[model samples]
Structure formats: C-alpha cells, structure tokens
Target: MDIRQLSYFVAVYEQGSVSAAARLCCVAQPSLSAALRQLEQELGVTLFARLPKGVTPTEDGEKLYGHAGRLLSQLQSLKASFSQPVARVKFRLGLIRALGVERMSQLLREFSNNVQGLELHLVEPDEHCDARIITPQLLKAGEAFQPFWHDSYLLAMPPGTPLSLQAEVHLADFEQLPLIKRTPCDAWNTLYPELVRRGIKADVRADIQTIEYALGLVSAGVGCALVPNFDTLLQRQDIVLRPIVQLKLERQLGLAYRKNQTSASLTVLRQLCQPVP
Candidate 1:
C-alpha cells in the first residue's frame, strides 16, 4: 500500500521466506508478515503462496514485481530530486493521428503499465509538448528526431475486386480504377503526379482525410484506396492491400524532442517507444 509495504513485499518475494525477509528488512517476523497480509488485502491479489519451507509468488505477484521494483526505484530517485514530499510528474506527449489503433494501443499500454507517480497528456502533433511521436518534418530547429519504424504505402481494394488478383499492383493498373483519394498524404502526392503524367485518369470515388475511414470504404466495395499498409488494414479479411511494384513508398515515423533538454519524464517517454509486432 505504501513504500514500506512494497519494500517488504519485494523482500519477501525475493527471499522466498517470511522469517528471512523480516531479518533482511530489520523488522520483527510477525510485523513483516502482517504487513504482507495488509498489502495483499489492499491490492486484492494473493501475492504469495505459503508452504512448509518457503513461499512462491503467484501469477499476480509476478506481474506486480516489475511495477514494484520500478516504483521503488522511482521513489529512490525522487530523494535526490527534492527534499520534501513528492508530487506526481506530469508528462506532455503529442502524437499524430491515424497511426494504426492496435500499434498505438500497445505502445500506450506499455507506458501505463510500467510506471507510477506520472500523469500523461496526449495531444495533437503541433501542440506544446515535452516530446512528440512524429515524422522528421515536424522537427523544429534545434529539435532531435530519432527514427523508430517505417510504414509502407499500398493499394487497398475491396474483396473480390479483379485487381486484387494481381500479385503486386503497378502504376498502370490504377488507370480508371475506382479510387478512394486519401488527402494530405505524402505517398499520394508522389504517386498521384506520376498517374497524372502518364495520362492515367483515376476513377476518383471519394475524397477523405483519415485512413481509418478510407479502409471502411474499401471494405464496403466503394473503391480501391491508397493507404499505409498498417497491420490492422493488411490483416483484415474484407480488404486486400497490395504494394505497388517498382514504386517504393514508405512513411517513416519517430520521436522528436528538444535538442539539449532531457528530463526524467522525457527519458521515461523515450523508453516507452517499441517496435511494431
């Protein structure tokens, strides 16, 4: 429930014996055992399974072990940060929209699960921020960009479309193909001009901004759409995403932060960045 209780719990978990953990913590055996009981009651989780010899941590205890260690470490670090009572650290993190829902959710779950005593502010890319997950172009002067992952742009077509039969879509294949035009996309900017230069008149079906909605149109048999080959889209049974042959288009995304400023919160923010599964 508190720092002392967590310390005792960690000791008991690691030592695997109540009497030994109590001795290590310099507390009486009954008092340390009582503290563990109170912590378990407060958390509503059975932290340890008692045996004749020693204790074994339950699945719930194993899950809480890492959080307890980090929280204790975080508290220890705060001792050098200030001489008084510590308050929650607020972190402002900006993110661009339409990074696949599944990937973004996984990244955020890692951020939320690992750390305590921190508050998060999620906002748009251009807003005021401590750090932002975005592409390099959004980097301002004196800001540093650390590249993380790249997403490929592919043509999304409704199920059973004749073009979906092709192994890889070509530029000429887009000629007169009913299309869902996703605007403000860099890949579209490059691919559309070439389509225009070749005198390929794309059958423009719809003009939309967000890729999430564009995928829906593709599923409904409205038309083919050009979208980043996000896992959520590529794996969907209702739509097919095919990379354009000989035209390599990818969007690189990463973290951007002030050049010379590194706070504890920024370090924690950077640690949360993970590879897409």
Candidate 2:
C-alpha cells in the first residue's frame, strides 16, 4: 500500500524468506511479515506461498515484482534528485546482458569496497548511467572507451560426451556436430558466414537468446554451443569447456562514458579500471 510496505515486499520476494529479507532490510522479521500481510490484504491476492524452508512467489507475486522494481527505481531517482547534490556521490553503472547477474553482483561488491561514499545503481543498457561496462560493439561516437578485458569463446559440450575428451577442439569438429546457436555474438556473426564461404558447415540445431539458455541446452544433451569463458559459466560442473585452437575468437570488453562530462565517481572508476602496464 505504501513505499515501506512495497520495499518489504520486494525484499521478501528477492531474498526468498522473511528472516533473510529482514536481514537485508535491517528491519525486524515480525515487522516485515506484518507489512507483507498488510500488502496482501490490501491487494486481495496471495503474493507468496509459505513453505517450510522458505517462500516462493505466487503467480501474482511474479507479476508484481516487475512493477515494484520499476517503481522503487523511480522513487530512488526522485529522492536522489534532491538529496544527491549535498550527499555522497551516487553513481549509475550499466552492464550488458552478456555479463550475468552473478558477475555483476561480484563487480559491485568489489567496487563498493574500493570506493568511499559511493551509492552505486545498476542499470540496463537503455537507461542513462554515469558509466557502463559494455562490449566494443555497443560503443558510440563521442563516447570515450577504455578497454577492460577480453572474453574468448569456447566450445561447450555436455559432460562425458565424446567431444569432451579432446584437449583442443578444432573448427572442423563442428562440421559433424549439432550446434546450439546463441544470438548477438559479434564474433560468430563474422565467423559463421566466413566458415560457410570456406566450405565449412555449421549445423545449427537450436537458436537461443542468452548464454545461460545455450548452456542449459548443452547440459541437457541438446547440442553444443560456443559460449564465453565467463567465470560462472566456466565453473559449471554440468558442461565441459574446451578451447578452440583452430579459430581464435574473442570480443573486447570496455567501459564507456561521455567525453566532456566529468564527475568524481566517474574519475574514481576510470582510475580503478586503468590497465596494468
């Protein structure tokens, strides 16, 4: 019904338990529970299903989560508009979808530790942010780009599969295998056509939008996909990752910000992201 109640609801939905959400909000458990009950009563819908271990969102809760996230974000921006002038620096950072949520969280934790008096906001690609962690493909004119790192693509196969035994898989190996396709790989866009022109075949059995989805299909024995050697994906025990020595492909990752604008937080981030000599 109110901002506080909605905050409590969002925390509960995200954290999955009243106790956990209470710890996150720095509020009492009973008070947080009372707020959820009040919200449910007002909405006349059960938002979450109470379970022995924790809670799971109901269908209605899932629907409410999207709206609540936007509402809270806007509210924070509105408050920041007035308070930000005199308060500690509030910085917004945009991350591309290729960097999964877990990776983003890890980066945020590191940034929080390194910077003082910084209130960091994680944003999507479309939103206006102080700076963004993005691929070179998304860079625009007048935006200053700083190369951060490179992520190489690797062949991802289901565990114990015949191809998993190979120390290094060649591009020719893909000719005989059913490949799972993940969209928006700049490297693949160029490589696929060139492969076809050179008499190599990529038998794409499935097309997926995200690396996670492609990895899931690979784990299910659906087919193999070319996935980025991201930390979380590389650590997955369900799939086997092998280097593609025949065709080396990688995309450069970077931080981009407007050239003329200067901010304390942005300066700090630039200093931190400076490449080692």
Candidate 3:
C-alpha cells in the first residue's frame, strides 16, 4: 500500500466517515474508497468494518493503524528534512499560556539565532487547556512528537500578600484569603479536586480567563490566583510568585513533531530546554 492509501485510511479512522475523510484529504470519495480497498488487499486483512453511520477499525486494522501513524510521521519528516538544509530547519511549536507569549517569542528568537537554518512556527494552546485536551490529538497524528519542558505551577499574589515570600503555601492557607481563579474549564481543573480534598473550597472572588487577566486581578489585590512560574509577564515588581509548598501544582511544556523526523536543529532546541539531571 502506498503512503496515499495509508493517509486516506488514517483520515477515515480519525474522521469516522469516508466522505468526511475525503473532504479533509481533498480527494474524491470514490478515489478514497478505492485506495482503502487497495490497501486492504495488499495487507490481506480487512481494515475497517462498514456500518450505517461510519467505518470503524477492525481489530487487525486497529493494530495496523498504530504502525501506519508512525510510518507516515517518519515519511512526512523525511520530506520536510529533504526540502530544507541544516541552516534552514523548520520547526512547529505549541505553547500553552503557562509560557507567556512574549517569553515564548523571545525564547524562539534566541533559539533560532543560535541554531543554523532554524525557522520557528509557534502555536499557543487554546484556552490554556490545549496541553491536556489537544495533546492526545497531536500524539495520535504522530507519535514522534515530544514535549521539551515541564513547567511547574505557582501561586501569584499581590506583592504584599502575607504568603508571597513563602517557598510554598497549602490550600488551607489560600482558603483563608480571597481567590481569583480560572474557570473550571481551564487546565488547572486537574488540581481542583485536590484542593477540595484538603477541605478547602475556592472562594473565587473573580473568574478570569487569560493569565494576563488573572495576574491583573492579583495585582489589583482582587485575590491570589494560581499561575505557572514560567510566566515572565506575571513576574513584575508589583506581583509576587510563590511556590505551592504543599500543593505541587504544575504542568509540562515541550516540543512535538513526527518522531522519526527529529532534526539536528530540533535536537539543539531540546538540549537548551533540558531539565537538570
């Protein structure tokens, strides 16, 4: 089976409809169907089970799908590598709000200047939930992609807050004060239950969306809000970031791309962000 056939198959599996996959793949339905058939014939196994609503991968198809995804990622990476020289490496980066936009851009600029032939394409996570919500989609699309950094979460408070200088603060201490929080929809949702377990109910004084807004609330003394330590924007003189001594609130940041397609430039980028051993 050709790469085109595998591409069509994977698209069908992901989209759940041949017609939808056809639209996404920019190929006619008939051609996509024909390719699927050709692929099944070559493998001598039934890859999908036709149903009234859509196609589902058969057991054998499921097994092949995993391998097919990795193979395609490698092929795509190879194509990208061949098209660009070492001095012109193209990189796609996804950043969550934990890493402020200004800091991310600055880091990318420095990274590009340091690495020869490096181009950076940066995408911010949507609604701060992209790391958990969208990362699986990226992984399924290509297993070769991996994240490079893991940023720990920290609590942000107005400069004079009593807890500002402490290395960490427990949920109980936060409950004693007013809180400004990202809505339950934010990625920090994963940490909410732990707060509840500590017998602390978030006394949310304001519900904010973006990190800038949350920091703004903290600066205004609206309440303390949890933020990632990597956010340089919140590290201003007016604001104080203190590690959560008891609650290790944290998330990871990293590079992801087709695994086999990892380039020398990408390696350098990864090395720069590598955590201390």
Candidate 4:
C-alpha cells in the first residue's frame, strides 16, 4: 500500500520473523507485527503463516515479497536521484559506429571535466542491431532522447581508387566497384531505391559489423566501404575517403533518458557533442 508497508513486509520475509524484522528495522516487535497485519488487511490476503519456530510466507506473501522488493528498489533509486548531489546523475548514451571513437571520447572527457556529478555510460548498438542505432520510431515516440548530429556518410577507399573528384559521389559509380555494404536499414532506403533507378546493382563484397572493421578491410584492398567522415580516419595514410556523390547517406547520433526530467549532467554531455557551425 505504501513504501513503509512494503519495507516492513520485505524485512519480515528476509528475517523470517516479526521480532527479527523489528530488530533489523530498529522498531519495536509489536509495531512491526502491527504493520504486517495492517498490510495483509489492506490487501485482503493472508501474507505469512504463523508458526512457533518462525513465520513462513504463504503463496500470496511470496508473490508480494518479490513485487515489494522491486518497488522498494525503484523507490530508493528515485529518492537518491533527488536527494543526492548533482554529480551522481547517471547517463546512458547510444551511438552508431560512425560517430568516431576518438571524437566521442574527447567529448566525454570534456563533459566529465565540466560536470561534477555526471556518470555517463556509452553504448554502440552496431554490434547487434541491423538498424541504425537511432530509429525514427524512437524519435517519433517523443521518447526522452535528443539528436545532436546526423553525419553524412562518406566513401572510404584504398589510396588512388580513382573516384570522381566531384563534391558528391553518384550512386552510378558505386555500382562499378565491389561495395562493402553496411547492414541494410530504413535509413538507407532512399539510397537503395536510387541505386535501383540507376540500373546499378550493389556488388556487396562483405557484410562487416562496424565502420572501423569495414574501413580496415577497405584499407587492405578488400573492397570500398561507406563510412562516417570522422577526421581521425582521414589522417590515416593508407586510406582515402571521398564524399559519396548523390548517395546522400547519413546516420543520426543522439542521447536518451527518461522524459520530463532535467539533468544538469546531461546538459554538460550535450554541449560536449555539439557540432561546430
């Protein structure tokens, strides 16, 4: 019925007797017993079977014990979020492979330095999911998430692969080479249709996991790859990246948390990942 009742119920279940629960709760035995009795009355179910040796939880009591434990844990977390200092706020950030580890790491370091109470957890979903880490459904649901950047995809090739010197690479030319395709997703649906229009079939040479792995294969002359234009990879001498003309490939990057909750720590993180004008 209430947090206190749940706490008392859990304590009795753990200690196996009201007297023991009272000692653990720092309350009188009679008070603990009364709380348990009141809880059972409110719920209209017998909770524990009384015995001389100890009280054992009945079927209903066992079920309530599990639910009450979870409820109390969540309550404790909620209490901590408000009562604890700002530096204790926990964050979970999801990223695609193309965001570039070096760039993301730098952003995280800067954020940590600026925000005292911040704890950030970063996840790369490319290893598991076929879709881009950030989906339209996730955004449209008005989920407590915000997009920071949507990077246009680039073509990575071995040095001197002779891609056109144009500002953007056309899908027609992509058909001419052995393409190392990233996994198929709705994000690239437009580009795939354009490829079909041009009468060019993608010669998918490999289906690699992450952009880095695909780039490694590209650098080794396995096949060309489409990747994010993270400046760190551009510095590598063995690989050359050109803007993919006409393909217009891009991936969105963002942060998510529970809605309507303002977090100073999250704001600091967003500033770190802000794109330069």
Candidate 5:
C-alpha cells in the first residue's frame, strides 16, 4: 500500500528471511517484520511462507515482487534524472573497507565497463545493498557465496624496522611491536584472541578506522599495521610486507546474494563474478 511497505516486501522477498532483509536495509528485524505484517493485513494476502531456515515467496508474493521491483526502479531513476541527464540503473553493493585501495580501484574500473548504467554505492557497516562483495565471515544466514579474487593480511611496517630481517614472522615476533589498531575489523578481531593467548600485547600507537589510514600510519613509521597484501603497497618502497607464520589471515572475497532470488542488476554481477581459471 505504501512505499515503505513495498520496499520492505521487496527486501523480504529477495532475502528470503525477515532478519536478513532487516540487516540489508539497516533496520531492526522487529520493525521490518511489523511492516510486513501490516502490509499483509492491508492487502488481505500472505506474502511469504515461513520455513525453519528462512522464508520463501508464496504465489501472491511472487506476483507482488515483479510490480514492486519495477516501481522502485522507476522511483530511483526519477531521483537520478535531476543529477544526471541520463538515468542509470542503481546497484548498491556492500564492500569491506579492509580490501586495500588497489583492489577496490581495480574492481570499480572493471565493473563499470562490464555493467552499463551501473550506479554503484559502496555501503559498508550499514549494508543498504542489493548484493555484497564481503568475506564469508561477514555473510548472512542462507546467503550463497561465490568466491572471486582476494588476498591475505600481512605485517606492514616501514623499511629497516626491528623484525624486517626475518623472512617469516610469528606470534612470538609481536612482543614489543608497536601496532596501529584498526577498530571494528572482524578479521583483526579474530587475530586478537590468538595474540592474547600467546601473550603478545600490541604496543597500541594509533586507533584508526580506514585501511588507507592504517597504511599511511605504517608509512610514517608511527607503528606497524596489519594490512591486506594487495595494495599499491606491493610497489611502495617505503613499506615492507612479511607473512605471519602462525596466523595467515586470508580474505575469501566473493559475491554474496540469495541464489535464484536474482536481484536484477546483481544477477548479472553474479555471472561476472564466477571464479575463472
């Protein structure tokens, strides 16, 4: 009946679960559920058939999905027309910030050329996205993930630092190591417990957010930081990268979406993301 309800319906239909849709929409699960219930009451039809794992579209739900998708697309196009003469198909994608600058830049360039009229929005922490290119660790329940290109985390420090002579670093090497804390990183958090268990306390120097800043701090000799191996970093003479023998944190980057749900633009992206030989 209303735009909000229609949007909620579309999210639930695509996500196949109210909880998953709530996360994608950055809303509380209860609020999203209440909206769907109210919409179902107003329309006099059940939109979804609930299951133990997740929800599936009912016959009525499938019918509404078509109309709602088109309607939302039109509204988005209308909004875009004011900014640019040509209205583009919007595709909101969630990208993890930990993925370094080189990879992100390359992906954007490659994707734009492949998908025409692609209005890509990199929504993170707050995932208001049709599809997400995040690691498996961050994926929602029941979402099918197709792994693409990715890399591992490494100990990044300025040249001639204390442990630079060692070809392979270990948890024991971290004692007295000054570290930049990149907060709210799931991968970093996973490595934290192991460091604690090994009695390797990070000589906390900088508490930063973005990976770019973390790298910048590393370059400045402020402190060493754990950064993804890929980056314009490989080429940078200022920084040296060494693998942690004990904890090799490799990121499984991929296309995460509901299989068969086929978000219009993301369906094409899914095909493009197939692991190549």
Candidate 6:
C-alpha cells in the first residue's frame, strides 16, 4: 500500500520471520508483524503462510517480491540522484525490436556520457518515451518524425554457398534454395505480398522468430536468410550479403517524438541521430 509497507513485506519475505526482519530493519517485531498484516489486508491477498518457526511466501507474495525489489531499487536511485547538486533528467527512449539493440549500444552509451544530468531509459516502441527510434510502419500520426537511417534488405548466405557468389540474386534464382523465414518482420510482410503479386513462390525452409536465430541457421549453412544491411550483420566474414537485384526493398528509419516535447538531451540526440545530408 505504501513504501514502508512494501519494505516491510520484502524484509519478512526475505528473512522468513517477523522477529528477524524487525531486527534487520531496526523496528519492533510486533510493529513489523502488524505492518505485514495491514499490507495483506490492503492488497486483499494472503501474502504469506504463517509457520510456527518462520514464514513462507504464498503465490501472490512471490509475485510481489520481484515487483517490490525493483520498486525499492528505483526509489533508492531516485533518492540518491536527488541528493546530488546537479538535477538528473530521466529520458525514455523507445526502440523497435528489428532495429537491433546491439548495433546501437555503443552510440547510445557515447550519447549518455556526452550529455550531463541525463539518465536514459530504454522502453518498448509504443510506450511513453522522449524519443523513439522506429520504422515507418510504427510511426504515429502527429509525432515529429525525422529520418535517421536508410537500410536495405540483403540476402545472407554462407560464404561457400552457390548463391553467395552471384553478383545479383533474383526470385527465379530462389526456387532451388531453401529460404529461412523470419516472422513479424516489416521487410518480410512487405516483400512476401509483392512476391505473391509477382507470382513468385518462396521455398520456405523454416520459420524463426529472431534475427539472431535466423543468422545462426544461415551460419550453420542450414539455409539462406534475408536480413537487413546492418553493419553488425554484414561484418560477419562467415556470411556473404548480396543485394536483391529484382527486389530493391529498403526501410526508412526515423525518430518519433511528441511535437510539444523539447529538451537539451533531445536536441543533442537529434543532432547525433539525424541523418547527415
């Protein structure tokens, strides 16, 4: 119900006894037990099983333990930041899963370091964030969108594969090869429809969820995969990336943020992420 109650709940859950938790928290045992009882009453859930010697968390208590721990950690961080002379600005950033977090880690870390009093929080694509790095499909109506990067889809194959040596690969060239499928991809969703429109059949070998898994399959020479022209993916010497000659598909990435939102950090992020003309 409150910070104190949550703290007490966590203590008893960890210590497994009211007396032990009270000693650890420097509080009276009766007060600690009363706090836990009050918390359970407020939440309308039996949080623990009373034992003769100690206590054990019930199902609901186990679930709340994780949440309470994280909340306490965030509260501690908030208090510590407030104690400092410089005010800390919490900045949320939303990233599309397909854009690849590993590729952006270094650049983001550099940005975080360069900007003083800035605390970056990574969140889901649709959540509230100061700025969002998202694809065109995810771009909302009123948010300010700035083109950040232009990425093309490339055919990735093992280095020694027959198609790897081709200067250009076509739909017809794919008939004999087994294609590794990546689901929930904007590129695939767009490409497949066009392929169907053109009456080209894709000989799908497997349907995978993540790019890493798809790349793993390609690396093991299980089958060829279609992936973005990311530097991280392209830099692999074990795989060959060839331009799709017949289908010149590419995605335009942009930063989307509310028009009313403006800050020093956002300005610096815009400068860093905006494409150079």
Candidate 5 lDDT, tens digit per residue, 144-205? 88898767788898889878888988888778789898976665787888889878887889
TM-score against truth, every candidate = 0.66, 0.63, 0.52, 0.56, 0.63, 0.65
Alpha-carbon local distance difference test for all models: 0.81, 0.80, 0.67, 0.68, 0.78, 0.81
Pairing residues by index, what is the TM-score of model 3? 0.52
Cα displacement (angstroms), candidate 3, residue 217, comes to: 1.2
Stretches of model 6 off by over 4 angstroms after superposition:
1-85, 101-103
Poorest 10 consecutive residues of model 4 by lDDT? 126-135
lDDT score at residue 220, model 3, on the 0-100 scale: 89
RMSD to truth, every model:
12.6, 8.5, 18.1, 20.5, 19.5, 15.7
lDDT of 6 at 61: 97
Q: After best superposition, candidate 2 residue 67: deviation in angstroms? A: 25
Model 4 ranges off by over 4 Å: 1-88, 124-137, 162-168, 184-188, 273-275
Residues 181-266, model 4: lDDT tens digits: 77643334656677878798877888866776887899888888877766445555677777865556676666654465565765
Stretches of model 2 off by over 4 angstroms after superposition: 1-89, 100-103, 113-119
TM-score of candidate 5 against the unseen true structure: 0.63
Model 5 regions more than 4 Å off: 1-87
Residue 183 error, candidate 4, Å: 2.2
TM-score of structure candidate 1: 0.66
For 193-246, candidate 1 gives per-residue lDDT tens digits of: 888888999999999999878989999999998888664344356788788986
Indicate whether candidate 2 or candidate 6 has the larger lDDT.
6
Candidate 1's C-alpha runs over 4 A off are: 1-86, 274-277
Looking at model 5, report the run of 10 residues with the lowest lDDT sum. Answer: 101-110
Candidate of highest TM-score: 1
